[model samples]
Target: MKKLTMALIALPILAIGTTTIAGMKYASDDDRCERGERYSQEDRQKRNPDKMVERLAKKLELSQTQKNEVKQLFINKQQQRETMREQMQSLHKTLRGLDPSAADYASALAQAKQKAAFMAESKIDERMHMKAAMQKILSPEQMAQFEAMQSKRKHHQGMER
Candidate 1:
């Protein structure tokens, strides 16, 4: 009887735990748009630069000219980002290829770290420049709204898009 009772208790507990976990997974996709908090997707289609610009244009109520300008800007930035990604990937592969027993491993690793630090600085500078460029393109009212939206995204995503 005790064994049966324990099994019964365990079954419901397991079911509830699974249900809670499943709910959490779906919850992550829910956007609190009213609060200016968006749950960005990692999907390749959603991350496409042109699609992102379209979303931005709709949200900011951008004129056709402004939308074209922002689209061009995003395209340029995306190209630059791809280059940086390739460089970072090379650095990552180099680090992965190093053998711990190699005498030069430490020095080689240090140099990679130095390169990574410079890349990080470059990324920050590029982000600032992009923000400035966007602000220049936007009207004052649109810029304020854009800033608010960006600030919220930064709060959620560690200042990354």
Candidate 2:
């Protein structure tokens, strides 16, 4: 009976100890980055265009036509980003496969880096295009509010890093 009572008490302590250790294991930046990447991939798979439209409509008080346009814009931008992401992944894979001991390795790595930069630039350009499209869709006050929201998002992202 004494052993049973001690075991019962120990069970909760053991559980809490394991939970604390598990939480601490994920406290590093590397763990957070891996988790963030996994979460983003899952989120992309689960994200609904209609739900995004509804949320944006509520936030921006968008008209029906504006909502439709914004939905299309979001779809196009996501497609572009996916294409760019694929290209970047391919470049990274190529970089990983190249022999570091080879004479051409430096050139190959540089070329891969250049392609990655180009892909990144394309994504930024696409974002600028989206911003321009939104400018046409949103009222001046709405655009200002949108810019403020973007700034806040960027600030938060910077803090996260």
Candidate 3:
């Protein structure tokens, strides 16, 4: 009787846990994307330039001048990305007005691709600028250290997979 009662209790607990997991799996993708946990602009600013410079300075053992220059570079890149995001959002809004089955769909898709290409170009430009700025700020030895750190991070990420 005790074994049967214990099994009855365990069965409901397992069923409840499985149901919770299944419900999460079936939840709306849009609802997940637009959830209340989204970061605000203020949160983004707090996370950028200033926080990045502090972290990089510790990792690279940067001088005051190098830290200042790196921070400025990060700020400029962040602003450029924000502008690109706005342009992309506008293009997406325009694309949304066209019917998916219309002949204009091809033209709309082409414009969307152009916008995506522009954003990608801007990202590459930002990365190049960052590399150049880092090169100017860091010594050869420091650059080696940075590369090693990046490699370790990549390896750790791969292990997680």
Candidate 4:
């Protein structure tokens, strides 16, 4: 009787454990965020530069000329970003191949740091250019709305954390 009771208890426990694991596996594909902030794949894709400009254009009621100029600005920035990504990838691969404890590792690390700093500076410059373009294209009212939207986005990101 004791053996049968133990088997009965074990069966339910095993079932529960399996159900939990299955739920986790299903949730991960839908919810996993490497940065720990949740966003769906399509939502993230819509935030890409072109889509973001389209979204902003709709919000601000941009003229056709303004939209074209904004699109070109973002395209330029995207090209710069792609170039930086390639350089960073090369630097990372080089760093990965070097032995940490080796005598040459210090020089390799220094080179990687320099590349990273340069890339960071370039990114900042691109952002400044984008901001300047936005200011030139958007009216005061539109700019104010844009700033508010940015603040709201920042607040939400903070809340998610």
Candidate 5:
């Protein structure tokens, strides 16, 4: 009778512990793409890219070929972003050397701005490419759903600020 009573008492504790651990894992995974703590390329490669492909495939009902193409597109975009970030870092270093108020500083600043603009353009192109790739994979309804989700996310972000 004592063993039975102890087992019943321990059961709820074990269930609650399991629930807490599972909830923490889910929260961490869901917030991987959040700003400020955005996942690095290595982390994305390890956890996100494949998971995204899988989830998107399930959500969009993608075929195997489409999934493959979308995955490649994502990988390419990730690489391009890494390259753009490196270019931005290099340009920042150049900007740091020039005196902000000097006559020559205008030309230096212009050059830096040009480089920054190019980087931004590159990222825009990458986004377009990824969207195009996704379009090939997702049905019209699924595409609309994805767009709605993106819009909602942006709105929520704006609200948070």
Candidate 6:
């Protein structure tokens, strides 16, 4: 009877502890970068593609095919994002290497501005493509759930800001 009583008491405490831990948000890579800190290994692993797909599959009750499709989609998105990131880095390098005293400074600056705008547009294009592809891939119910999840995430992110 004493053991039973202790177990009952411990159960609720354990539940509370787990709930609190689950509710806490950790810093993302972008947040760490903006704060001039490095992303910890744990955070990097959290963003791994397989981990993300597994989480989504569990949340949405995805079938094997859906899981594979979503995983591929994520891979494609990451590749496209990396390409854009490389371009942005190159643009920054170009601007940084330019001599302010040089006559071509203004022209280089103008070219950089154009590239920046193009990158911004490319981002929008990627977003639209992803949305369209997801709509085609996810069923109505899953799409609704996915959109709701996205909305909640955006809301939480906005509150952080």
Q: How many residue pairs clash in each candidate?
A: 0, 0, 0, 0, 0, 0
With a 3 Å backbone cut-off (N, CA, C), the pairs that clash in candidate 2 are none
Badly placed stretches (over 4 Å) of model 3 are: 1-9, 17-37, 158-161
lDDT of 5 at 158: 96
Model 5 residue pairs with clashes: none
lDDT tens digits by residue: candidate 2, 1-161: 99999999999999999999988977875563555455467567567778888987898888999899888988887787778777877987898899999999999989988888888788788878889999999999889988887788888889534
Candidates 4 and 5 compared by lDDT, better number: 4
Model 6 ranges off by over 4 Å: 1-34, 38-46, 159-161
Candidate 6 least-lDDT 10 residues: 25-34
True lDDT of residue 23, candidate 5: 73
- For 1-161, candidate 6 gives per-residue lDDT tens digits of 99999999999999999888865534343455454465565764566778888998998898899889989999888778768878988988988898889998999889989989999998999999999988888999999999989889989889534
What is candidate 5's lDDT per residue for 113-158, written digit by digit as tens? 8988888887788778778877877788989988887778889889
TM-score (C-alpha, index-matched) for candidate 6:
0.70
> Please, what are the lDDT tens digits per residue for candidate 1 over residues 27-124?
75454443555444353235677788788888999998898899888888977877898898799999899888999989998998999999999999
Residue pairs whose backbone atoms clash in candidate 1? none
Decoy 4 TM-score against native: 0.70
Using TM-score as the measure, the top candidate is 2
Ranking by TM-score: 2, 3, 6, 4, 1, 5
For model 2 the TM-score comes to 0.73
lDDT (tens digit, per residue) of candidate 4 on 45-83:
554777867898999888888888888877777667668
All models: lDDT? Answer: 0.84, 0.83, 0.81, 0.80, 0.79, 0.84
All candidates: TM-score: 0.69, 0.73, 0.71, 0.70, 0.64, 0.70
Worst 10 residues of 4 by lDDT: 32-41
Cα lDDT for residue 13, candidate 6 = 100
Model 1: lDDT to the true structure = 0.84
lDDT for each residue of candidate 3 in 1-161, tens digit (9 for 90 to 100): 99999999999999999999877863865443454555568666776688888888998899998888888888888887788878877877877776888888988888888888878887898788777777787899988897788779889889534
Candidate 3's TM-score reads 0.71
lDDT of 4: 0.80
Between candidates 2 and 4, the TM-score winner: 2
